[model samples]
Target: MTDLDAIPDDPSALRAALLAMRAELAAERALRRGLEDRNERLQHFIRQLQRMQFGRRSEALDPDQLNLALEDLEQAVAEADAEAEKADPPRREARARERRQNRGTLPGHLPRIEVVIEPPTTICPCCSGAMHIIGEDRSERLDVIPMRWQVIVTRRPKYGCRACGSAVVQAPAPPRLIEGGLPTERLVAHVLVAKYADHAPLYRQAQMLARQGIALDRSTLASWVGTAAAELKPLWRLLRDDLLGSAKLFVDETPAPVLDPGRGRTKTSWFWAIARDDRPWGGADPPAVVFTYAPGRGHAHAATLLKDFRGILQTDAYAAYKAVAGAAGDEAAAGSADGGVLLAHCWAHCRRRFYEVAQKRPAPIAHEALRRIAALYEIEAEIRGRPACERRAVRQARTKPLLDAMRPWLEQCRAQLSKKSPLGEAIGYPLNQWEGLTLFLDDGRIEIDSNVIERSMRPIALNRKNALFAGHDLGAENWAVLASLIETCKWHAVNPEAWLADVLARLVSGWPNRRLAELTPWAWKAEQDALHRAAA
Candidate 1:
């Protein structure tokens, strides 16, 4: 029976029955809304899965490929337009005049080659007289020259004295990178740059050389790489020391695969990267990065890599890093000037968790968290490149209040969620690392994320992708050594090829070990700049 049928006839009883019916209706509406919300979330989750499985693999074409396709299309259109204009003389005249007027000049740095075109005869068509030059329209297009291989020959002559006959004199030959071997230091540098910086494997380089009829074996190229890496190890150590000496740095690691010949399979390794870029705060230190390869990713590995490093270490919320921070807490508590490392966690990581939740389902809490984090990053953008003191003051004045409100709000939201829920876990991440996440408010030198070191890992990733796996642990270590110097050169905007070429030559000439700092990318760039200014 309906509730109305069970109602009493008395006036007060009827009013109570109506109230009971209204309460039941409201409860039913709430339950229906909850079910609808859950259904909507499930729908979104399914759609996300479907998209992942069936969508285009990549969001966009590779930049280089896109540019090449555009170049071809532009050329084809130009050719077609030219043919059309040629079929009509008046259109040809109009188009030629417009094209010449609209043409852009190439860069001035490129060497210019001039070509002069003249009529069949140097006489005017109207009269049999010589034509004089008028204002000439000039246009420029870019060009390229293919790589050329050459050999250098050195000879030392000896002469015996006529009277003495025992005395002989000869000049000493210049130093060679490969003793009694064919390749020069410059060639070795090229191989290093191509393999490490350009991500071309030794076998591919050997094939390229073979195409040119050089016919060098892959093992020979590998030996040259190993030799160069041995010579460059000291520079890599110096770079590591230079970065560790800084008070603040970014540290991160990525997996590297090495072939396990005994098992005929691959084993996972790690490349630990430490980097510093103080340009954002107007600090004078030039940017640098050094990568160290380890057999495993463990707390012990991090401790060894950052053994003497003290001060702010920015990184993702990896437990290994947290372990390092915990170990250093003792010295920090003692108030030592060179205290243990203070962990400054990445906000990007925190935001990423929320982003994943929001993308998969209807998550107002995650979305709100992301919006608030974005506001903090916005303030960072405005204060970038300002003095550290000013940055600190601005963060304290502006960013602190937002973070202050966000902390309690996040806690309150998490209280309403089940701990096992995706949104709950997203909220828990930042809360777990609250201290490290908020540490940036006190120090201006620290970045909001460890993207500096993360950026340095991309080349390593590319090399791994191309080469598949390193032969063994030792080969992986060599990869670390060369990658360190090559990436540092790139950070300083120094041409890796040119810097490696010059430094390899100097090392072969027995450059002083104590003065290895002079050969670092930044120092070498400074010296080059000074010479250029003097010449100017």
Candidate 2:
């Protein structure tokens, strides 16, 4: 029945009916607004996905942009839910209870401040008698304390001997990373970590310091960095020597631009990365990477960098690497074959060529190649972390047949296409490096790709994007030294800032050169873990 027909004749009854209708209408309007908001959000999310999939390369969103979009959508959803809860009070309570139940506990390492909230009285109102507590509720929330800066003042009092008044004695001054500088070793380490690890340039850091009422120039920070790099150069050299001594290594290089004041422009330099990670095959050696800055990307540079190395070098099909291996082979021909460096090609590089072709247009051959490579990757994933002998055996049993068939199929496909075509070139990459590509089948220690070192180069790229270019060649070398140590610390899951502070303090306090090995990231991590265990 209609509202009018169902209404009572009395004025009071009619007024009550009108109020109920108004409340119902308000709730309906709130529900409609919530639905509309949700619909708009869903539409935006769909459009983003479609654009990501079908958009032009130049129009596509980068990782950070995509993350930002998702964050906004999440916030919008939260707002809508909050409005809905405001409209329905009972639903608000239910949702709050559910959220409390699902909430994770805070970390135990953080200090807690207790706040006891007691009732006005402990007596029972009905009985007028004292009541004892039976239980209590407790909850925790994360909190943060803003960073504060303070100056450390040092003073030394000199005393004169009573008999020999001319002779005064006092304790000698402590050495620092920057002698007679305002900052301590810990503060200098923070600047280095912020610049290299966090990719905060010195100028930005100086600006941040200025906000905190400290007036420091970017050049002052740069000087601190240069002095730290000089002090830590010995450690970097030790790390490089240690990595090169590994029986298997992954190597890659990326362009690093340096400002050339004479030409009034930046010149392209290179940062060559050498990485050793044996954890994949369950080897005990800790993972580490070292970057060396070179003025040029030439065969001579690669040869000189690896002159003292004598092991397997896993890398992409870069021409300079081939020349280095060839020279090593020629030198070893007169002696032992084991002395030569062997090269293992990266299959990811080969797959990338095909992927690029498929991305541009439909190519059944390229898709088939990708599918086959993906299957090989799946098998590799299953055998990862297994012993070397077991991994080699599994590859021989399962991976060898696939590789055997893939090579012949690739040859047939290449024959069907023009040599200048994209598909033809993609197929030719693997066929050309068949020997090195199959090197992993015999030695499980060698990976299917040099992606390890490639992954290590990304931080350098991020730093380049932020700073644009280094001031000069020496600046680039310093960048390499600091970046190598910081990246190695990350691999070992150690705090780069803490480790750097301690190491810098030790170095300045006359840490013996012979004990430099103990200052390495892996060594420091081991020592820290040992201490924690002992404490436990």
Error of 2 at 485 (Å): 0.6
Worst 10 residues of 1 by lDDT: 67-76
Q: What lDDT score goes with residue 98 in model 1?
A: 67
Clashes of each: 0, 0
For model 1, the superposed segments whose C-alpha errors exceed 4 Å read 1-146, 159-166, 332-337
Residue 8 in model 2: lDDT: 92
Candidate lDDT (C-alpha), each: 0.75, 0.78
Query: Model 2 shows how many backbone clashes?
Result: 0
- Clash pairs, model 1 backbone: none
Worst 10 residues of 2 by lDDT: 67-76
Tens digits of per-residue lDDT, candidate 2, 1-536, equal: 58667779999998998899899999889879878977986676566555654566654555443432333233334434545554676876676567557544444444555545555454444444545544444444322223756545454334334433344434454555544355667778888888899898777787898776566656556656766776788999999999888898999999998754344455899999999999999987779999999999999899989987888999998999999898889879978655888999999999999999999998999999999999899999999999999999999999999999999899999989998899999999999999999999999898988889988989999998987776556668888999999999999999998899899989868799999999999899999999999999
* lDDT (C-alpha) at residue 43 in model 1: 62
Q: What is the TM-score of each predicted model, taking all chains together?
A: 0.72, 0.72
